[model samples]
Target: MSGEQLNEVRKVIWLTGASSGIGRSLALGLAAEGHQVIASARSDVELAVLETLSSNITALPCDITDASGLSFLRARLSHLSSHLDQIILCAGNCEYLDFPEPDWDMVTRVMEVNYFGAVNCVKTALPLLRQSAAERPHIVAVASMVTDAPFPRAEAYGASKAAMRYFFDCLRLDLRSEHIDVSVVNPGFVDTPLTQKNNFPMPFLLSAEDASRRIIENLESRPKNYSFPKRLLCLLAVSKILPALWQKIVLNGADGKARQDVLNEKVGE
Candidate 1:
């Protein structure tokens, strides 16, 4: 659809993780464009602030990791709108493993939010999306480019996003028959509350607002998979080609000593 067409037609959208980061920015952007955005997040304070931003936005606070809360959210959504034209699943959690004494449970914790949380949202939104009058109702999952290349300490996060990407890919195939468009958005480093905690270098990092704008612009096309920025995607492609070189760069110090040392310092702080 063209920019004019998007502005002409209003869509009922359900956006998760709207308290901060990309989700919050997306909700604001969509609402500004005259879309009815039902925004959700775990933070009541932040959601309340968002609700004050525009009448197009409705704050619905719910923890993606909480099954009961999500169930309640579904009921609330049903009451608010019988159908949804779009559902953006941006809710996710990230955790790095501390090697040698890694917190094993963190893997489950991360997956529960990043992968299963999205799954639950899809379950709740699919039926609503089926009722859409639009030619193609959309499901957008904000995954990560970390899945394209292996990163130390990002095992859980990378794995969860990879799983999400695959699941959505399969879902796209199945939902094609129903005219439900599914797009997996794989973003590189974006300066959000999540990435603000990173101690390492993040090349090509875009601000959350810029990232959200890019995503919103591209989403109009409803592509199967949208990954950005092109520069970072290219870098990851090169890394995959040279396995030995890639390993050397990732494990710079022998036995990953340099990586571990940095992590240890962060933990100390």
Candidate 2:
């Protein structure tokens, strides 16, 4: 369907991670476009701020890791007038593997938030999404472009996003007969509170608002995958297609030393 046609049909959207960053921008943007947007996040204050920004938005604060909390969120959704037309699973956490021994605990923590948190939201939102009368019920996940290539310190974060991408892709196949569309958003370095902690340079870094606008524009097509900005995506693609060259040129000993410095700084902090 065309973008205009899709926009004409105002959707009831459930957006997680709505406290800040891309999620916050998306909540406001969708509300401005006349969609009923249900915003979820652990920060009640932030969600409240989002609600004040737009009349079309409803604040629903709950931690994705808490199963009982999710049940409460589900109950709250039941009170809405219409079923969810789309679910954007944007709740995620990122953690890098530092020096010494590989921190399996850190890996699990990242997975818990990025992978399992999204799964928990999906468990609650799928029923509501199924209730939509629209030709296609959409599921949009915020995975990372880092998953396209292995980065030195991103062992946990990259793997979790990669797992999410795989899970959503498999889900798309399963939901095809039901006309449920799953779109995985692979964002490059977006300038959010999360990425602000990074000590290294971030090429093609986009503001949260720009990221949200791109995501909203692309979701109209409901493509299987959405990646940006073009420059970063192309860089990662090249790295994947030619690993040996990337290892020698893109990631040399200097890169390893820089990552070590980051780890040391984190430890000191």
Candidate 3:
């Protein structure tokens, strides 16, 4: 299909983690394209701000960690409209595992938000997605490119995303007969409030707007997997293809202090 035709296809979209980063950018971009967007996040204030920024957006704030809250989300969305064309699960958290001491609690926290939170949203949104009779339903998950290869100190964050990737890939198979399309978005570093906390360098990092545009563009194609910044993806591919060399030379030298900090934090915890 042509790009113009893809752009013309409009439908109701529910987006999680819409308070900031790629989620926020995508909400704005999709809304500008005349699609009805329900923006969700834990922060009501941020969701409110996003609602003001776009005429097509309606703020729906809820913490994905709360299962009961998701039921409330279902009720609220049911009130908005009976069906949804797409559900973008972007709510996630990242925590690095430092070397000397690994904090199990930190890992659990990351998993709860990154993995379980997404599953909860899926459980709640399935009915709405099923209501789409004309357009094929889509589920877009915001996983990380870090899952492509292991990165130092990214134990918790990477594992959570890896689990998410596996879940959606499995879901794709099960939802096939139902005509639901699943897309996994594996983004390289994007400048966002979350990454702003990183003391180390983020090579080939794209602006959130750029990331958002790429995501929206790829979503139209409805590819099973979408990963960005060819250079970073290529690098990760090379590392995966040659693990020994990458371990000794590339990955080991990236960020020493950050790795040490992660270890220290784990030890302290």
Candidate 4:
């Protein structure tokens, strides 16, 4: 189906983290659907390139984590349009804390970028979203599926996302009376510049384009919480119900026992 078929009305959308990864692909997809996309990211050069891809896209580069620097963003948006119909909060960072004298600051750093950065975006964009001509404006945030289960070395990343999850959930309740809809999307592994650096295996990973397509399609319904890749969700669910089993599996892999077991099988062969 065409984008027009998927999206009924064109919108003025503010999308963060549009320089790369899932955000970049999502911006392109939304722009192609005839929405006025204001793409924001820290990289000026890449945002420039993204703008060149479509006439509907306007590159407005800014760091979401910089509270003081967000003045520039607010000014730019005011100059661009009277109100924003939608805002997609996709900017985030991850830091895994390894055992044995890990840098404890990684938790604060991850929270600043992932959780507080989202807070900053929402605080700045709330008034504009309320001023939208659309009857019920939308706020969509890209969280993570990792929040459903614990993982080794994911202390910082998981906690930050968990906080984000709760924050959005409560925000959804608070905004409902005002007729503003909020959605928290928890996506599984996707093949992106960020995930490419991950050392462990990523099962049932999706390409950025595919992930973007799904997000656009699903957000139309505006479910309160959306998580993808059912297989991964099931694994995380098991981690909740049978935590000991999950721990056994995770510990085996983390301690290299799984690898040694494979080697033993190879030797027998």
Quick one: best lDDT, which candidate? 1
Q: For residues 54-144, could you state the per-residue lDDT of candidate 1 as single tens digits?
A: 8788887887777776667778887777788999999888889989899999999999999999999998888889988899999999999
Clashing pairs in 3: 98-262, 98-263, 99-263
Give the TM-score comparing model 4 with the true structure, all chains together: 0.91
Question: What TM-score, over all chains together, does every model reach?
Answer: 0.90, 0.88, 0.89, 0.91
Candidate 2's C-alpha lDDT? 0.84
lDDT, candidate 3, 1-269, per-residue tens? 22233234478888999999989999999999988888999899999899888777888889899977777889888877677889999887877887787887899999999999999999999998998865689999999999888777888899999999999999999999999999999999999998988877566779999999999988998999999986778767756777775565445446755544433343342
Report the candidate with higher lDDT, 2 versus 3.
3
RMSD of 4: 5.2
What lDDT score goes with residue 192 in model 1? 89
Tens digits of per-residue lDDT for model 4, 1-269? 22233234479899999999999999999999999888998999999999899988888888888999766778777677678889999988877887898999989999998999999999888988887889899999899999998888999999999999999999999999999999999999999988888877566689999999999999999999999977678766767788886776566665455734533343342
Error of 3 at 105 (Å): 0.2
lDDT on C-alpha atoms for all candidate structures? 0.86, 0.84, 0.85, 0.86
Off by over 4 Å in 4: 1-9, 254-269
Instruction: Provide backbone clash counts, one per model.
Output: 0, 0, 3, 0
Clashing pairs in 2: none
Q: How many backbone collisions does model 3 have?
A: 3
Worst 10 residues of 2 by lDDT: 1-10
Query: Per-residue alpha-carbon lDDT of model 2 for 27-106, expressed as tens digits?
Result: 98898999888899989999988888887788878889886677777878777634789999998898888877778799
